[model samples]
Target: MNADELYPKRVRSQKSDARRNLSFASRRRNPNLRMCQLLHLQHLDASESKINGSSICNIRSVTSLNLCGCTNITDMRLIGICTLPQLTRLSISWCVNIKGHIIGCGMSNLTYLELRGCDGLRDVNLNDISALLHLEHLDLGNCNNITGASICNISTLTSLNLTGSGCITDKGLSGGLSTLRQLQKKKQVTGSCLHSMPSLRRLNVSRCWRVHDENLRQMSTLTKLRYLDLSGCAVTGSTLGSISTLTHLDLSRCWDVTDVGISALSTLPELQHLTLCNCQKILGATLCRLPALRVLNVSGCSQITDVMLRAICALPQLEHVDLSDCATIMT
Candidate 1:
């Protein structure tokens, strides 16, 4: 928000991330910051700048803070952040320096936290995050040393993103893919799974290649999932039909996904937007069962011919279809 707009009690987020980082040069408070103390600022975006806790501790009413790309800030300043009782959303994406517990005590009101590129996310802090009883959304893409085990207890989460978390495996999310394996790999078990957070609506495990169909099946109690992105994972959509609430699904580049697995998706009556880009194995015959589908992306399906296109044509509700690079389709 601009200087003139900061006086309101119920402040909205700034229109852009371009806001100047409220810098307190050499711990000397900026005279320009005098205006910030007087206003009841609700949202602050000081990303990629020199803003520190010493300068920001006074902004008590701030409910949302975007510190994404702020390379200078460290976990030490989180004590200053914890002072803001109303702070809920904090984005520290790409802040590589924070190598310790980012969350301090007394910041329980937080509902959304994004640490997309921080490497300091260890089991020590990931376990602490479960204390946030009100937390609903968390993004830990490209982080390290964290598993579903560390976060399995946080039953309050509604949206979670583990994209590119290669350390995560089938045994982490599921007790074990098979009963035989369950005993062999029982030590890796996190007790509950996709079931641990039953309230989850949107989950992104894209590129978590260790995740598999057996990991997603039988043990996956994700009945509330509406948006699930398993793109580039090892999943074959074996038990995906059980997630009947799904509407938007992305299985792009999932080379193992086949027409047999795609057949199970036919049972998802609510599915509308489905993406299977580069998944060449499917011939597109089973997609006819998804009559409610509105958007379909089968780009790079080298095996798809005119016959497959004709099968997709039967989807009367299709609004946006992507069949690019299907060289086999003849006029």
Candidate 2:
């Protein structure tokens, strides 16, 4: 017999044992049990396992729950998790089949939530989140279907992550975040994030192919943005110049951007991490001007010459550099 036969997998967690049957043999001696402060329920190994509806209901006291990579489970199971009032943090990444339609759940106490890789999630039901007055941190990355309309309800949120969610135009940023400005002062709300949800210190909007420089201008109101990622976007140099306060920026795969556009990007004195991968137009001269840059990724920029390599070396603060796949860089 293997360990599987010796110790059968229990449906209810060990924590439920406290609320379960209290028999004479099991209860005669007091078993010293420790309470779990946080619970993460992921399906990394059991991606195809179907979550039993009844078993899911048994987990009530869990404050933090993760259901990432659980491909087999539907939105119904996720809805079940959100109904719990005590939940503070939740992650449901990579559950591709689940639709983004959230409605009628009491997510009032949630402070941190992650909804990455739920590609099918389309409509975010704002009515469900209006009561979540205490919510702070949220991540909606990689949900390409959700438009800016869904964000209209959660303007009270502070730290938001919108790394790869789709179809967020200038109107969306202006509509969603601007409404938030009414709730608090500039210091409380404005940071790197666009519109009014400004307390964001770090933001990632990479691969959002539709966003433009005008959208970045809306973000200039956010002076507190320390980390930003604009990789694979269509923003031009004019748009990049609008966000001069960024400390970390990733412009990899931004095909439309040229060396002229990046000229203003190097002006940020606090910039530490800069990535220009696949931005085919950038030369070595623009790379050398970044004085505070520590980590720079220039892979796939074919226009860089040997002279630019020396320029890159000239930066006093430069530390890490990626010259991979650039055929013309000097040896």
Steric clash pairs (candidate 2): 100-121, 100-122, 177-196, 189-198, 189-199, 190-198, 191-198, 192-225, 237-261
Q: Per-residue lDDT of 108-175 in model 2, one digit per residue for the tens?
A: 67866666677775555444655577766556666676665666577566655555554544344445
- The true-versus-predicted C-alpha distance at residue 263 of model 2, in Å, is 2.4
RMSD of 1: 7.2
In the order shown, what is each candidate's alpha-carbon RMSD?
7.2, 9.2
Candidate 2 residues lying further than 4 Å off, grouped into runs, are 1-48, 68-85, 92-104, 115-124, 139-146, 159-173, 176-193
- Note the Cα lDDT for every prediction shown: 0.68, 0.60
Candidate 1: Cα lDDT at 132: 83
**Model 1: how far residue 119 lies from native, Å:** 2.5
Worst 10 residues of 1 by lDDT: 177-186
